[model samples]
Target: MKTATKINTRLVVFAKAPQAGKAKTRLIPALGAAGAATLARHMLGRTLDIALSAAVGPVELCMSPTPDDAAWLGIAIDSAVQLSDQGQGDLGQRMACAVQRVTQLEPVLLIGTDCPGLTPALLQQAAEQLGAHDVVMLPASDGGYVLLGLKSPCPEIFSAMPWSTAAVAEISLQRMKALGLRVWVGPMQHDIDEPADLDHLPPELMNL
Candidate 1:
């Protein structure tokens, strides 16, 4: 079978509505419920900005609780960025669905809104790496991953895994290896998920 060349790439941002007591719940102890949700909103906007700045290709915001949720209202998302509902499932299942749906059009680089270290340049590098490798991953300091890019569909990488755990990246990589996929590991980045991780957050966001 002939493999399709990756000519165009899309950045899929998986985010949840910034609802208090539900968004950024891990940080609630240190920042309070409202504060955590406020920070979540900030991170979401920052992530969107990074994706748009990369300008590699179309950017899609895969939202949870549906796009019509009140939490998404008043946010100034660019008209060019498409918004889609993340259908029901666990984290792994939702991600697998997104990758399969978006890759039908072109290659997709999936990311989340929790990682402040995800920059436009880093996204561009991942896109470039995907042109040659079967997969590209940006590892998080917490042992999870901040970004994953694929030139083709690979659902096995996102199935039956422990979500929100330190073993996420390791398990995912092992799955990729078992499937004989070439993977490019990117720089180690940290995501804001706990009180300890607050130190890594931007000063402006820290105030929230």
Candidate 2:
């Protein structure tokens, strides 16, 4: 049997507690509030499982609203991973915080729970790419990115910029270029967010 090879790169997953009305709310129109929440729960669990199974490095679950908040009650996390709160900020701020902190210790891969295509192999590939490139970014079909791998913090890329818009990935790319950083960006992948994105969900999650 092949054994798992541990890499030095750290993997950080930013997620929100699967609370109804808050989690995966964009899908509520198609799946209903309770159903959307259920899907969110499944996504978070599967994302964590994939991250751990990758064995690329130590895994961290960075929670929004913090784990102590009532929103996280009854959620069971794997003991193999570390937990931290994505303290105060908008999306860009929260992500930058985690990236800056972890990259300070070691190379890191920053991801979220919304992408079904974030398989173990993809993560390992990203980590490998980081060996030669200063950064690796996997862009989302929605124009944002699903994963970002970095050996060090790039505050300019995350500060005072528009987020959630179609320009996110492009702007970040430009920032990296201006900084003279070597970057490797993968082809676009689907991020299951809005109701229209429901079509992109994996076969197993379709029933949900």
Candidate 3:
């Protein structure tokens, strides 16, 4: 029997507590604040399940707003990193912190809860690809990334980029290319950030 070679990669899932008035705030207009909050909780729960089931190595939950809030969610992970909205500055800062923390132990793959499209197979591919590349980014159709894995902690890629726009992935790709960094691009995934994004999700996800 051939034994599977374990990849020394840290799988980090970034999340936030599904608190009313705080979680899924963008969907409030269409799904009321209370409804949006409920959906956010459901979505996050599902995301955590997927991560826990597929993880091949140490997993980290990088919770925003507060990590303590995620304690009651009952999601099992190797570690949890609390993030303060402070000094986050923007999405870049938060992402950088996640990578830095995990890269201290091993290669890190950081993903968010928005991508219901993420699967265990894809994550494994990313980890394997990292063996030959400096970075691996799974671009989203909306111009962001669903997953980003790195062999080394590179803050430049995450900082000073225009976030929450279609150019995010494009700009990051350009930066990586310019720096002569060997990058691997994975299959694109859809992120559930806006109302239109809801259409791309499974029926059960939208109902939740």
Cα lDDT computed for each candidate against the true fold: 0.89, 0.89, 0.76
Encode model 1's per-residue lDDT on 1-208: one tens digit a residue: 3332445689999999988999999989998998999999999989998999998899999998898888788776778889999999899899889889888888899999999988898998888888888899999999999999987778899888988888999999999999999888999999999999988987767675
Local error of candidate 3 at residue 148 (angstroms): 0.6
lDDT of 2 by residue, 70-156 (tens): 888888789998999999988888878888899878999999999998899899888888877888999998889999988888888
Backbone clash numbers for all candidates listed: 0, 0, 0
lDDT by residue for model 3 over 1-208, one digit each (tens)?
3333347787777777777788778878888888877777777766666666666566666666565565345544334332333226578988887777677778888888888788878888888888778888999999989899887778889888888889999999998999899888989999887777777777787666
lDDT of 2 at 22: 88
lDDT order, best first, reads: 1, 2, 3
User: Which residues of candidate 3, in runs, are more than 4 Å off?
Assistant: 1-6, 69-87
State the weakest 10-residue window (summed lDDT) of model 3.
78-87
Backbone clash total for model 2 is 0
RMSD of each: 2.7, 3.8, 4.1
Candidate 3 lDDT score at position 34 = 82
Residue 192, model 1: Cα distance from true site in angstroms: 0.2
